[model samples]
Target: MLVRKMDSEVLVLATDNRGKIVELTDLLKPYHLRVLSTKDLLLPDPEETGSTFIANAKIKALTAAQASGIPAMADDSGFSVAALEAAPGIYSARWAGPQKDFNLAMQLVHYKMIISKSDDTQAWFTCALALAWPDGYCESVEGYVYGRVVWPPRGDNGFGYDSMFVPDGKNMETFGECNINRKKLISHRADAFSRLVNRCFKGRNFDGKRLLSFRQK
Candidate 1:
């Protein structure tokens, strides 16, 4: 019958951070999907009780989905320290302190790593993304990017740990220095969101396959 159906997947950005919404909106915009901001709905940030990234993301996504009955999305991301044996792995965001001073946080890490440079100072940024559909079909995806830390807060492009992280091949620039599109290409959040959006928007399943090769399931 050549029947066509409209995509009802309204991606709800579950965050009060306008910068994050803008970054994520640009990433998801290619799908031509409707993206809603948390501020638009006056949704209060939910208490994050989950101990892990996926758990936290799921909590936010589920909360939004329950409230709006739309497919909602959330990201829980953080830094992990190799020298500390990953002590601050899940505590990255909280480590920013009352002032949200990532420079201080970077200093603390730099000191620790300098003393224990023998260890794999190799750190990774991890993002766990959750998608909550109105029909109760929820899915979670995770992405990780390995990199080493830089000092003195190089640039002003990105927020949080991006200032300290020099991703895999890049030499001089921190993630904060890289443009939004460049950051999106090799970011943890992008990896997870790529999986999620491909599945939901394109009716494809990525599984463990490359994003470009996503096939209809």
Candidate 2:
């Protein structure tokens, strides 16, 4: 069973990516929870030695919660391409090199697929979210979205591999080309968040739009 203790309004969000922060903040704003970034707290980044997304998320959440002495939440997301046998699943960030140049990373994926002549460009995005309390309580949830890889990339809106990822059934719009609202609705993070809300936040109203506030007293 999933649960969130209602004692604290301050929750640390453990990520340095501003895009992720903005998206998460927008989604969580309705709950009236005060979300603080690791940067805001001057928290150090935890080493993601985990071999999986869930493990990485747990490592981050727990690290932040223990360091900041507050409740913390973290997420790990990545692209898993069928052709590459999920080559970049856990190494998604590392694949971009130290500078985080995703263009090179995307090119790497594109070439590997081409060289293999793997007609199947099928892929999916996976996101794992973990929430941890300072006293050691923790919970995690995962979500995914299936899609196909597109070559040469397109659009300039999103970061990472967004420009080359076209969700299934879509003719031409990569996530980068789509509007923020559309992307958010079908994103892996949103899917994970829905589960997180259902499991942890019992009785709260979340209709995927405006969230009505309900708190445990």
Candidate 3:
């Protein structure tokens, strides 16, 4: 059954990435959630020792929920290149080093691709979203968007590998070239968020602007 309305309830986002915070905040705006980030609460990020995206997301969410005594949401996302055997999958951020220099990371990808001499430029982005309650209950979902990699990473609109990725259906515009709203419409994160909303936020009534109430499922 669908849970009761979460009107004005607090939801802590278990991430410190400014880009992610902006995107997620925008996606969650309709729910009227009083969103806070781990940075805001002065909570230290838990070590993400999981092997997969979902596992990592769950770890972060559960850790934040436990620490804050409130519901928490987290997402672990990355870029994977088929030619590289999906390398840098879970270590996408690590590839950027401590400075979080994604430009260096993107350059590394291009360098690896060149040295490997792989004709295939196919790649994809993966995102896993997890929501956890203070009681230890948690749920997760994964989403993906496939496309090819582009060199000389174009545009500056997005953070991370957005410049190096051109999602399917987008004429040649890299994610960095597209605006946030346009990117949100078809991003891997958006896909995951949509699934989450369908599963958890289902039965909620929306009269265009405001959410009325949640219907019993």
Candidate 4:
């Protein structure tokens, strides 16, 4: 009896960010699972009280799973600058303010660096993903991609600080200069997704062994 799985694979994407939704939808499409965004379900956004990306991601994922009675996925991601001592780490989104005007945020970052007379433009983008089940089981993975800050922000391909970020080893192309496909190949989110796919999505198990093979590496 080749009993097939019905609508048992519906997963709620616990995010309202269209960029993340698009990226995740493409990444998860191969699984043939129904992925719904928070907007699609009209779910109230949860307040993030966590001090770290991983913690925030878990909070969102758990909230979605509990509220929707379905498996939920969420990611917390941001840019951290070495010169500014990671000032905008968890506050990346907040820095953009309610209007989500990243141009203002990028200017702030640039101003901080210039005022501090800091030459260390080194920075990195990090992403933490959490997958939660309705039964209260959850798994998480994090990833980072190093880069340098750029001024006179270029391109308009990506949203947020993309225009001001110059990723390493990519011909000095900022994320905004690269298309979605190019960005996916060298993004912190992609790194996190790779580990997540292996750790949890591979078996779709909440009790699976915690895989740290791709963390902070």
Tens digit per residue, CA lDDT, model 2, 80-151: 999899879989988899999999999999989989888998999999999898877888999998898998
Better of 3 and 4 by TM-score: 3
Q: Candidate 3 lDDT (Cα, whole model)?
A: 0.89
Lowest summed-lDDT stretch of 10 residues in model 4? 208-217
lDDT of 3 by residue, 1-217 (tens): 6543333267999999999999999998877678999999999999999999999999999999999998899999999998899988999999999999999999999999999899999999999999888878787889998999999999999999999999887378999999899889999999999988876666554433334434454
Q: What is the Å distance of residue 175 in model 2 from its true position?
A: 0.7
- What TM-score does each of the candidates earn? 0.83, 0.91, 0.92, 0.89
| Sort by TM-score, top down from the best | 3, 2, 4, 1
Please list all clashing residue pairs in model 4, or write none if there are none.
Answer: none
Error of 4 at 74 (Å): 0.4
lDDT of 4 by residue, 109-155 (tens): 99999988989999999999998877777888898989999989999
* Residue 38 lDDT, candidate 1, scale 0-100: 72
Put down candidate 1 lDDT per residue, 1-217, tens digits, no spaces: 1211215535688887666787789877656667897778888888889989999998888888788877688888888867778746778766778787877777878888878765576778888888776665567788888887777768888887788888888456789898888888888888877776655545422232223322334
Better of 1 and 3 by lDDT: 3
Q: Could you tell which candidate, 1 or 2, scores higher by lDDT?
A: 2
Clashing pairs in 1: 158-176
Local distance difference test, candidate 2: 0.85
lDDT of each: 0.74, 0.85, 0.89, 0.84
Worst 10-residue lDDT window for candidate 2 reads 208-217
Model 2 TM-score is 0.91
